[model samples]
Target chain A: MTSELAAGVSGARMIELGRGECLALLAGVPLGRVGFTRQALPVIRPVNHLVDGDTVVIRTHPGSALARHTTVDEVVVYEADDLDARTRTGWSVMVTGRASLVTAPWEAARYRALLIPWTDRDVDEIVSIQADLVTGYRLLR
Target chain B: MTSELAAGVSGARMIELGRGECLALLAGVPLGRVGFTRQALPVIRPVNHLVDGDTVVIRTHPGSALARHTTVDEVVVYEADDLDARTRTGWSVMVTGRASLVTAPWEAARYRALLIPWTDRDVDEIVSIQADLVTGYRLLR
Candidate 1:
């Protein structure tokens, strides 16, 4: 149990978020960074995402580098945060899961409705993550 | 070599950034996300950073989970971006390398001068990534 005094003295308090709360926070943010490994070296890309049910979907070019990085069963991490530097307060949520393409025509169309390509790219591919673990933290001042 | 027409049609054009240019963009941003593997699962956390002559140094708590994940010569990725959803235009930069503590007392103090913790945490650990690859792209509408 972290005391309010200790938290106040540090000017930042760390609070853990439950699984459901983490999902809600993730759903609230539009932009997130996806992390995966390429050549055994970790790589991360910033992209916009949509939370549908328990899975997260994102649109990208079929020929883009992202597709090459997380196509089949690659494990990836998606993270979003709304932190304020001045107040030293905000929340961050991260979801870890396996990424796969949405190949079903009907499902693709449905997902496309929620996740739109922010940039003018073909964005023909929809990558959905079957989240395995979700966690979050809130920094309070 | 992307054509102007394609960019105009999609309103999101992708342009690659030069090495120096990418570093400049990185310096401009106050925070970025760090990606690494924990128990074979990829994880990420947003952090404030300082770009030294060539390496990136970040401050973290000694007991924080991140310290446990990155101290062992594990390869990591650091990323930052700025995109406007309305315009679908912005820049994204990523750096990949190994993370280790800044053991030298003087180096740690020097880095502390540049990178300050936004929240109240011990933040006594200085993790530095020796970037092996630096890449970036700009989306123009």
Candidate 2:
């Protein structure tokens, strides 16, 4: 099937990861990069995230650009990986979804308490990305 | 100056990185994520790269999507970071540039020898992104 491609490298092979495995690996990692279009160009930022089922959530300060700009329905890309540079063997997951600030008081408050942002800034905004598409790959030896 | 911003996080502060420091940091890292638009949506991929002056170079197989789509003058974003997950302290660099396949026989030959793909697949295409804009930040404790 054209579903994936495998290529060998120094006894290691690249494999396409399934959705279930991708979500599990994402939950295990605390940080990832978020990509969005701004000024008609792509922008990426490193942020810590939490996986709620298939949705990804992140906390940010109100003063942050990500918080100010992502008000409602912003299509974005979330990526995280645990690859070792020296070994070049690991897995990376990419999630494409629409990001919106969590406006519901209950959900926002719960995330604020559950997810400690990588930055120590006082975070007042929680952005939830509903995954529309998920793709991942792993390098195995 | 609007050139930079600083925010405190615990005992650390987030500071904007200068261009010189950004380039130096990128030169030290071998891998990064490249972002480009596909079908009006943003896509991110983790690929190993080399910093040549203000340009970033990557090798991809001709069969790969990146090589097929990025024929010439495509705007793309390249991001790389070195941060600790536990401490969340590190520097991240984001570069905006026009990516084009290296067509010159001499240049392609040189890069083909210098930059090795992380995957062991046969790679025949060399893409060079000329950095038109460079931005970076560091979380320091």
Candidate 3:
């Protein structure tokens, strides 16, 4: 469990990724899934994201259950990966942190300008998650 | 909240998916993300899965945290999506259900042969999540 390397049955080895590399990979991806608790059960929503400094930011509408139910300092998980199914090789990064609504007008405005929502909806709420714990793995042959 | 039409800013309309359609889409995907609680916080993992009947099954090694920590009847969320970044059109399906380890020798063997593990690791544990509540959305431009 403590080892960083785990070889799979398909002749691929899993290498643990560093924080710096994880953040870099996250910034390059256009989409990610954010997981939060709803009714004490997990709920995942795939949304476009932008890496702002050390935080992961996403725009959601007021009508979205994700934005409406997320309380301040709520723990959430954001994951993004770039993998090839054919080769079974790629990297996946998961960031677990506290989620809070970006209520500041200027901050929200900046995020809105940089992070465009993939769905056709108004950007009514901007949620920023502090990347407190980052873990990732890369499968290599 | 109940009507099921939410359009994104990119002129894409979000249409809710039905149970039958969600299952069909899930069967077609080779990969998905499973979200479960770890230490009272959400954890998301990308794993290759197979839709067996109405359940999503994935194999894991014993050392993996997901398999080790997941308890019987643990509420989990499994999600799979196929989206085009350029066109901003795609479909996402989510299934929330209880996760149980496949302890039956025969059942485990069947899943082992059918569901290929993405990583190069031994298949020591098999997890099956019942598709209790299936929900999805299709983004159409």
Model 1, B29-62: lDDT tens digits are 8888998887888889999887875678898889
Poorest lDDT segment (10 consecutive residues) of candidate 3 chain B = B1-10
> Candidate 2 at B81: error in angstroms?
0.4
Considering only N, C-alpha and C atoms within 3 Å, which residue pairs clash in candidate 1? A120-B12
> Per-residue lDDT for B32 in model 2?
91
Residue A96 accuracy (lDDT) in model 2: 94
DockQ-based CAPRI category assigned to the predicted complex of candidate 3: acceptable
Tens digit of per-residue lDDT, candidate 2, span B4-68: 12222242478999988998999898889999888777888888889999799987788666776
Per-candidate TM-score, first chain only? 0.86, 0.85, 0.88
Query: Runs in model 1 with CA error above 4 Å?
Result: A1-10, A63-71, B1-9, B63-71
Error of 3 at A124 (Å): 1.8
Residue B39 of model 1 has an lDDT of 80
DockQ of every candidate structure: 0.45, 0.35, 0.46
* Candidate 3 per-residue C-alpha lDDT over B57-140 given as tens digits, one digit per residue, 9 for 90 to 100: 987787666676555478889999998887889999999998888989999877777776666577558899999999999999
Q: Is candidate 2 or candidate 3 better by lDDT?
A: 3
Q: Model 3 misses residue A44 by how many Å? A: 0.9
Candidate 2 DockQ category?
Answer: acceptable
- Best-first order by lDDT: 3, 2, 1
